[model samples]
Target: MLDQVHLPPLAQDFLAYLSLEKRYSPHTVQSYSLDLSQFFQYIQEQYGGIALDSVKAAHVQSWLALGLEGRKKAEDAHKRAQPPASAVTIRRKMSALKSFFKYALRKGAVKQSPMARVTGPKLPGRLPVFVDEHVMEKVETNQAGDDIPLFSDDFAGATRRMILRLLYHAGIRRAELTGLRDGSIDFSNGQMKVLGKGNKERIIPLGTAVLKELREYIAWRDAEFPGYAGGALLLTAHGKPVQAWDVYRTVRKALAQVTTLKKRSPHVLRHTFATHLMNNGADINAVKELLGHASLASTQVYTHNTIEKLRRVHEQAHPRG
Candidate 1:
């Protein structure tokens, strides 16, 4: 493992800029740091060592190739060769290099970035996986049954239901839902304020049923843990803040019984929300805003699922017999 002190100055500067100025989430910044550290370690091994700004496009390409080859094993003579990194992983590493070089150029640390000429490996397109509408409805309507462990009277049960409900109805990311405060929801207006990527805020309208459930959950939470005075909207039975994994586990447990879809996590609920909206004639732009997506391109992927739904409807309904 490369030590922090050993990282090149330019790389350090770029990471600092990402954290301090760009205000990227810690998770995102950590990913960039890991990607760059691996690249730099490859640099020390291959080229003895070179400044980040002085590195060329060929070096970046070589790094990608090495990443795919599993780090050129030197640990043991009889050690089994490791499998190559996936295309997605390689793409993210290259993206980090490209982003770092771009920042270096902007900061006048380098006159030109070698990544300007470097192109990432071609990645296979995968459609966003979502829960089927019938399955989702089943999960939503089915109360604290055998699959879902939590009962409404208990703290765990109420929180689990609230977690699933907000993710399905609001279509917000898990992080946004995790950071939600007591003030995030406006019961009167039936709207929710969500903090998305890069700390961007967006308002999501809530349905009447969702609003009613929110009110019930709040009342139950207060009565269950009266002394707690935290700002977080959701809390554990002990009145501690809810973490991301807590939400994930709750979502996973709730979804396991209903969804045969392999990726049964909270995010799939977001996809289901978007897919259902578009299938029911919601505008693409409107869904984009509700989803807190920065680009229309990101939102357009849901259209593929919608189009498939239309195709199935046409085949089933059109009978000229």
Candidate 2:
């Protein structure tokens, strides 16, 4: 819930709009709240508490500068120095302020948005990391080249394997995977409905092999815990619903076997799914829909990976004159 007492009326109203009207996740709402609170506090400390409507672009720029340059205390030599925020962190704060002010403008709370002229620091371009196709194939089988079974044989092993497959094949986020219900999967249609960020729902198509594995896993799960009638699609060993960390640990452990990437998480599987699809000639718009991205820009990042792959192929195949 939003802290009503600390925030100004307009800020609180903006947060409420984000929660009720915009349908932002609790985490996202809390982030906006924190960002607004921090900015307000900074205003109070730096400028003796300026009115919300009175805040200007200069104040926003100064706050961003403070993020880059940690607050200094000249008198306290022994005090621990505050570290500067990362570009990403500052960028998020900037975004939060922009959104809040935009809301305020729409609601007629302010004559103009202070964040209108404020520009965030430029972020460096980073390509998404993904496991190689050969390595991914190796992930499904053991060292002896035997196909891993997801049946009544071993519940724990089957659960872990199923988690890895769902993340890779379905390309769902950790939260989406954990929040899934048994009814989310439409076996007849070979598709699964996932609730994504901002409470947006999207349908992802499942392949025959993945669908078969899912059926086997669900059958084993139901048989193992007959008394369990929970709505969650995935469960823990204790028959409780799976959490974010559960998905992360499973992906990390499984990916550790096939690849040595520094960052091995459920999102890497998501990246892998998109990267593979782009490499194999999947339409960008289709990939966007599959990944549940709100904009074509978000989905366009995968094209960078495709371009890099093509660069490598051209270098290898072309002969120098």
Candidate 3:
């Protein structure tokens, strides 16, 4: 049932390399496969059997142009047509191409990369979306009042609450959180050995409050699932390992109670973590390490959110008028 119709042999080889050697997540590999497939399909239909290395810059340019305009005709009438890809998506595809070509060049599959000189669509710089500090506090506490607790006192409630707390306090990605095993948490050191993108590992320090919650949750989990043999740090009602979607939905529902942000995701907690750190005078480089970013550029985005917050405070509190 595997469709290898339009994918060129070299492209297929490159994808295997990404999966096997680069250790990219399946989702990332699948994305690269889709992007490469689109490019190769366009090349086969439009240019007719051009060699992989012989592919011109114009071919890549034309493919991107068609994607942006949504002008490419669907291969079949049964397929639902999608709108033009947004700039962000287009940029991602371009990056995929760049990475693929880099691999291809190293293997001598291509003389040079067509994407070397090709420029992708300019992406608009947007600040990281985060919940306000006060809202985040409500999300974490879920205190009992005249109303029901935000996170109830059941296993499901504890798992959901812990998911949010880990994401916010650790500033870890959804995948990192989902992939955590019992051994991933180093309780003795107050740190977590997170396996980030590309199988890279970094030690993220866990705060005292988060560590306390984690211990309580672990005790609760052991008692709730006495026969639990699963290795994942989090589990479902059936004592099965938690999947990415499980964490996403749990965070989504938890965030819905506390935030009005249009995009309520576990990632919002990550954003909130970095932003709060910057607001409290945490160094950007230090936050970068905590967030496990490969480069400072990626971490710098959170600084904008903090700067905007400072601007608001200055506007409201400064008595120049």
Say which candidate scores most in TM-score.
3
Which candidate should be chosen as best, given lDDT against the real structure?
Answer: 3
Pairs clashing within candidate 2: none
TM-score of each: 0.62, 0.62, 0.63
Ten contiguous residues with the weakest lDDT in model 1: 143-152
Better of 1 and 3 by TM-score: 3
As a whole number from 0 to 100, the lDDT of residue 57 in candidate 2 is 95
**What is the clash tally of candidate 1?**
0
Q: How many residue pairs clash in each candidate?
A: 0, 0, 0
Candidate 2: 10-residue stretch with minimal lDDT: 143-152
- Residue runs of model 2 more than 4 Å from their true location after superposition: 1-121, 142-153
lDDT of 1 by residue, 1-321 (tens): 555655688788888899999999999999999988878877887898877667898998988886677744585456466678898998898789889878888889888989878877678767788888777776577644566534455678778888888899999999999999989999888899999999899999999998998888888888988886859999887788889999999888878866667788889889989999999999999999999999999999999999898889888898951
